[model samples]
Target: MPKITELRGLFKPFTKPLHRQWKYVWQEKGKFNEPKLTLPKALNGRQLNIIDPLHDPDPNALPDESTPWTSPTRHPMFEYLVPPLPREQHPLFHHDQPVFLFDSKTKLHAGVDQACLLTKAIPFYELPQSIKQNLDKISIPNQDDLIQSYIRQSIAYDATKEHLPRKSTPLKQHRSFRIEYGIPRSRQMSILFENILHLCESLGGRYPDLFKRHLYRNTPFYTTYERYGEPIHLRNKNSYVLTSHTPLSPIVKRLNKLEISSGEKNDEKLSTHDPDGHYLMKGNDYQFLNMYPVYPTIDLQPEELYQDGDELGWRQRKTNEYVHTTFYVSNDELIHESTTDERLARMVMFAFGSALVQARQQYPNGNLIKPVTVQSVFLLDELFHFVVFQLNTLNYNETNDNRYNYVWIDKDNYMYDNRPSMVMHNPVYGTERNLQRYVLEKLKYNPDVFQKFLALYLQGIQGKKE
Candidate 1:
């Protein structure tokens, strides 16, 4: 029990005195849990003293100003100088490494609404009709056999999955624990990618040189973008898998080759004259989405502005400079949920951002350089979202630069549906028959999707450039 003085010191600054707390009743147990009937309900039609009557000549009739909550401010008998409540520090105030390590740092992840805004790209939802028509032309050697083998591997991976450390902590924060169910998301992703890569490798004899490219894990691809006079930086420290080398050919021809009128901009063409959806409030950009900064945005001084494109430890001499494909796996993490539309947004932004970085590395001075292209594959839930971005132009100029990047998004792709396993593995649900309960049947396998994946992979392998 706290001392009366201590209790008062703690809560009195923020709370009101008993008399000042009008209309609030502390009914005694003597009342046997029944609420005290003060007066007839004012809004009730049958109440005799109800205020619905037309006459208002009762001059001496005083109002119930003394009732609870009658005054906005406290109705204390004597006013005294009340000190404001003491402010407390964050839970992890003493944490050696804070969430944002540097001063006034903003971590902008690739997201849906800001994808077009960040990349300054023209979005062609789904693969273009031309790409679709060309899909049947690019045939993978022994694709059916490969897919079956791939499916087998995928199932095996799924059936064999076992939880390692089933629970973990937040990023650098202590004491707070997070419980993860089933196989870890990272392991599930790894298994999925491993299966895909293994399947891809099975064709090494036929396309030997195409398999020469390397795959990197948990790589960081940090880049900066300026939006609405604010420099937003994205330090993608957890890019699941980034396949480098193997140049990609754009589905459409380069912007410089095509003769587009100087009077027209791609964004404007997409937006028309209407200010809707994305353009609903231009001055209010991402802020208008109702998703603000996780913590209060740190106000920085003028001196804190950075030199922007500082590629971390990625040297120019590295042979595998061109980013071929990036694999991202998203789930219901504490930070962001992998919703359908949001996943597409992430894929587009990730593709464009990676391409921009690659472009900057190759053409430092903004001289004559071929466009950089990046393909992003995002896996959320069981669905796969594919995005291909061709970064045609970047900041040698202003916001509405005529030369815009081209992006194609196809998010309605799932490799294979989950299935009930006789191979009895991890418990996916309750204590019994978890596998049968959770996994979806594998009957809904889509061969065309993986074919498209292979097509995207092999597009420019035939016509490789330096």
Candidate 2:
């Protein structure tokens, strides 16, 4: 045989063509090759009765009494294993204790501040002026033009992905026949936020890393606390909850944070009282003027079996315990048309703040280690309800001058006035029905509203370097 030489590829040209060169080069087995394969053994210590090939089986049934057995075993390990009994018991219903219900299915209470009273939050009408000034100061590249582009692009994605507003089913009700149908609010909201984040990355280029470390979605969390010696709980899930490695710097002034005068904590009707008046605010008292004759806890249904976890969207880790913001897009479960924007904003701040306080692993009736600031936005269709909550203490029973928590809300922000509509003669209704109908034409965005949203998103992260 010719001397073997080092080669690089499979199809190298040979000087003299022959069968021997082909055999050594292609078919020769070396150290890397394994021995011939062995068939797997049969189960239950009995070999499978295969006459020849896998497809060849005994066509005629052999009687079990006449069949010959090679071997049998009485070993205990060969028998099927039985499952062990459960150590803990699980119940179907909450029989022992009733937990106050604050889930999505809960209806709107008569008073706007019901959730506030339960969570021990003080409500402010507008956002802090310092935040507004900071918003105005934030700069963007060609923001006016980019805002409109983003608005159009987001709507395009929503329309292309989802079915258009066309007549599908025959409805008997007149109110149900809508010629101008708005796209699904939740879907559109996600598209818009994604586009905005992309824009922020293009301009500022730090949001991607921030979101990687902070943002999480669909993580279930709940805060358990007591109200008037009764157990209460609130769960927050299926929303975008952004957290940070460290707590947000306190927003309220040092003096105001130290103590909120009972006068400040009291309602407007009580506002007329002397500025220096000494008012004693009770833990269970309804601070606002009541529309409902009963207590704020009127409709809270309870559960004996409540989730004991106080996670802020992740497992107990060394990072991202502090919640920075929660973007609540309208889910039909949590938001309804009957509830006003103002009330919804208040409810979100209370529920989210309670979650943060619990995440800190602090006692519900005691002071928090530090202030937990949470900024939130509630987007329903086009309206944007912005809220900022600073939870200082969960000690509602404190008789001292300590301030509990603060919530700042700006409820009057809209992305656009109306979507441009065009008349279309749709044939789905047939010739009998009037041809008068309107279809979505295009989207015209607002610059100021988008700026406000961007400002809120970039609030605490502006000072960070690349």
Best by TM-score: 2
What TM-score against the true fold does each predicted structure earn? Answer: 0.55, 0.64
lDDT of 1 at 8: 41
Tens-digit lDDT track for model 2 on 141-208?
78777666666555542444443344333243333335544444466667777676566555445444
Q: What tens-digit string does per-residue lDDT give for candidate 1 at 376-434? A: 77764346777878877766337455556667788778666655322122334422234
RMSD (Å) of each candidate, 1 decimal: 22.8, 14.6
* Stretches > 4 Å off in candidate 2: 1-95, 157-161, 164-184, 202-212, 255-287, 290-293, 333-336, 341-351, 362-366, 420-444, 462-466
Report the C-alpha displacement of residue 315, candidate 2, in angstroms: 2.3
